[model samples]
Target chain A: AQSVAQPEDQVNVAEGNPLTVKCTYSVSGNPYLFWYVQYPNRGLQFLLKYITGDNLVKGSYGFEAEFNKSQTSFHLKKPSALVSDSALYFCAVTSGAGSYQLTFGKGTKLSVIP
Target chain B: DTAVSQTPKYLVTQMGNDKSIKCEQNLGHDTMYWYKQDSKKFLKIMFSYNNKELIINETVPNRFSPKSPDKAHLNLHINSLELGDSAVYFCASSQTTGGSQPQHFGDGTRLSIL
Candidate 1:
């Protein structure tokens, strides 16, 4: 079984400041990590993913994430925070083989205060 | 065009009623999934289908059934709905079941059981 953890229930950041939403995962084998964002009354949008090779993966809307195997973490980051970027962020993990389900973490609500 | 879409964005019914939520993906993905976001905002997997075959059936109750008539479409049917079933049901699809293929999601159907 695969599982993910997002420790913070809510993250507050100032506009123009860098923001980070931390995530950690546990799986039997190499894990496939992902970050998704959900806007108000909207569906989840894929942000970034860490499959192989590059530890730092860039995704849509100027967002990026770093995959740290030693730490078992995949934290989403942005150089400049925008108020529009405030939303519910979720981290997910799935094993490389056998299982097809993606275990998602309890979402972290991001609030970019102006 | 919408990559993934689900119908009846809002569903309201009474206890012991039966309802269904329909989902369609135009991204030509091979795998589709059903998820539930409860009042606490925890996303949990309900079921998964790959190429019209049931693949991942989580610990969801038998009252919940999933049907994938085709690769592009997967639907969820709920029988004898309970107040606990009131939540947002989201449908998603991915290009493949393995790797870091990001799953695209729909706006979700908010089921309010009164």
Candidate 2:
């Protein structure tokens, strides 16, 4: 079975400061990781994904994630945070070989303070 | 033009009532999925259909049934709705099951049981 763990229930960062949301995964085969953001009362919006190739993957709205194969982790990062970036962030993983079902984390609530 | 859309944005009903949530996608994708988001912001996949055929069913209760009329539509029907069934239901579509294809999501239908 594949699973994802987002250790932090909430992450706080000041405006214009860098922010990171940690995520780790456990899967049998190669992992296909993804990040998604959800605003209040809105559906999840895809941010980025890490399949193969480069470890650093850039995504929408100036967000990026680094896939650390050695650590089995994929953390979402933003160079500078904005107040509008406050939302719920979810990290998901799926097996590349079988069972394309996405397993999502508990979600990290990001609060960007101005 | 919404890529993915769900009807009945807010549903409020009493226990034992039956309700249905409808979803449609115009992205010309071959795969569609239904997900449930709990109050704690935990997401779990309920069902997935590829080319109008059932592909993934994630141990959901028999009270919840999903029907795909065509490639563009997938509807969920719940019988004997209970208080525990209240949650935000999301509809998503992807170009395909595997690979790097990102899933597009609808705004979601918030179900409230009283």
Q: Pick the candidate with the highest TM-score.
A: 2
Interface RMSD of each: 1.4, 1.5
Per-residue lDDT for A1-114 in model 1, tens only? 678989999999999999999999999889988899999899999998888899999999999999999999999999999999999999999887555688899999999999
**Model 2 DockQ (Cα-based):** 0.71
Residue A113 deviation, candidate 2, in Å? 0.6
The TM-score obtained by model 2 is: 0.98
DockQ of predicted model 1: 0.75
Badly placed stretches (over 4 Å) of model 2 are none
Candidate 1 residues B1-114, lDDT tens each? 888999999999999999999999999899999999999889998989999999889899999999999999999999999999999999999898875688999999999999
Instruction: Return the TM-score for each candidate structure.
Output: 0.97, 0.98
**Model 2, range A8-90, lDDT digits (tens) per residue?**
99999999999999999999889999999999999999999999999999999999999999999999999999999999999
**Collision pairs in model 1:** none
